[model samples]
Target: MFKSILVAVDGSEIGHRALEEALAVARVMDASVHAIHVVQTGTYPTLILSELEPPDIAQQALLDALDREANEFLADAEREAAAAGIRMTVYKRWGHPGAEITALAQELGADLTVVGSHGRGRLDRFFLGSVSSYVVDHATSTVMVVRG
Candidate 1:
């Protein structure tokens, strides 16, 4: 019986599907849902060119934009959970998505963690890396991967 469900949402359609799946499971189990949106800080590369603006300013701008997007999608998830009469908590973290999600799942002692997969081929996953795969491999709790 799942009492605490953790879901990772990134504003992607697949992410939304993952949320939906989590919500459904939470509803069935009468569990609390915890949603996390991780802004992948490692994805951005430092620009060494002198023509570019200061690194601090550029980094801040990028963080700000990512924060806005995270808030938007999290808000939507909250509303959807509310409509379903489920208790949902939202969290935002800055780091590698896979690490953050697994850490939060442990911190919250989540019974299950749900994530979405793009279902990309081997080559695509090799190049792009897969958050869902990472979670499945790293999370201490049970993991559910919903393919897009």
Candidate 2:
């Protein structure tokens, strides 16, 4: 019996599937959805300028690109929620995604959290640890993981 559902998105096809599944479930339950994208300040900054004496312009451009991507992630989720006829909320956090998504679900008092089985990995179950696994292990709320 979820009243508020929080779903994490990372712009991956799997992430989109998670969003769609969350929307469908929420629609059936008449639950409000909270869609979030966490921008973990990981190697992204370093990738901007891997060379010795990094270019400032490159660093700035990378930051700008990250910002644009974050916005697009949130906006797309919002649109999906609307199209599904579900009430929705959006959030962006910059830090450890696992911690942030877990914290936000608790902070928002969500009854459940939904996330993708793997983010950006076509063979995720074999490749790497995914955001879904982290959420399932860390979140206090009930989690529904959707596989793509």
Candidate 3:
């Protein structure tokens, strides 16, 4: 009986699946879907985007690129939701993914927040940290973790 659904997307396959699940639920419950993609502007970005060059690179440039990418990802998610006859609102924020997502959900008064887990092992998560785990533990709303 969710009236408002919040789905977190990171342009990953698991994230896509989570959005699909959110859409299905929204369709059944006649709920509004809100999607968010965080630009990840802290230390976590180093671990998350290891492929990128060192931190010595231009910080502003990197953030701009990340914001553009986040917008593209959100646009794609919006298109998919629109195709299903669902009007989804998407947002882009710059911060720790978990914190931003949780804050947005609270701000929107979301009834449910859906996130995708990368399914990294405990050891890896312990070292690199897990955004999904953080969101699951910190979010006030009901949470659904779509694992991959």
List model 1 lDDT by residue over 46-129, tens digit each.
Answer: 523245565588766776787898899899999999998987999999777888999999999999999888522344356454
User: Candidate 1: which stretches are off by over 4 Å?
Assistant: 47-55, 119-129
Candidate 2 has which clashing residue pairs, if any?
Answer: none
lDDT at position 95, candidate 3: 74
Off by over 4 Å in 3: 44-57, 119-129
Error of 3 at 20 (Å): 0.4
All candidates in order of lDDT, best leading:
3, 1, 2
Q: What is the lDDT of residue 130 in candidate 2?
A: 62
Which digits, one per residue and each the tens of the lDDT, describe model 3 over residues 52-79? 6554456557766877888889999999
User: Could you give me the TM-score of model 1 versus the true structure?
Assistant: 0.86
Clashing pairs in 3: none
Report lDDT per candidate.
0.84, 0.82, 0.85
Expressed as tens digits, the lDDT of each residue in 1-148 for candidate 2 is 8889999998998789889888888888888899989876663655445557655876667777877999999999998788777768899987777788999999999998988877663544564546677888988879988876
Better of 1 and 2 by lDDT: 1
Model 2 residue runs over 4 Å out of place are 45-55, 121-127
Ranking by TM-score: 1, 2, 3
> Which one wins on lDDT?
3
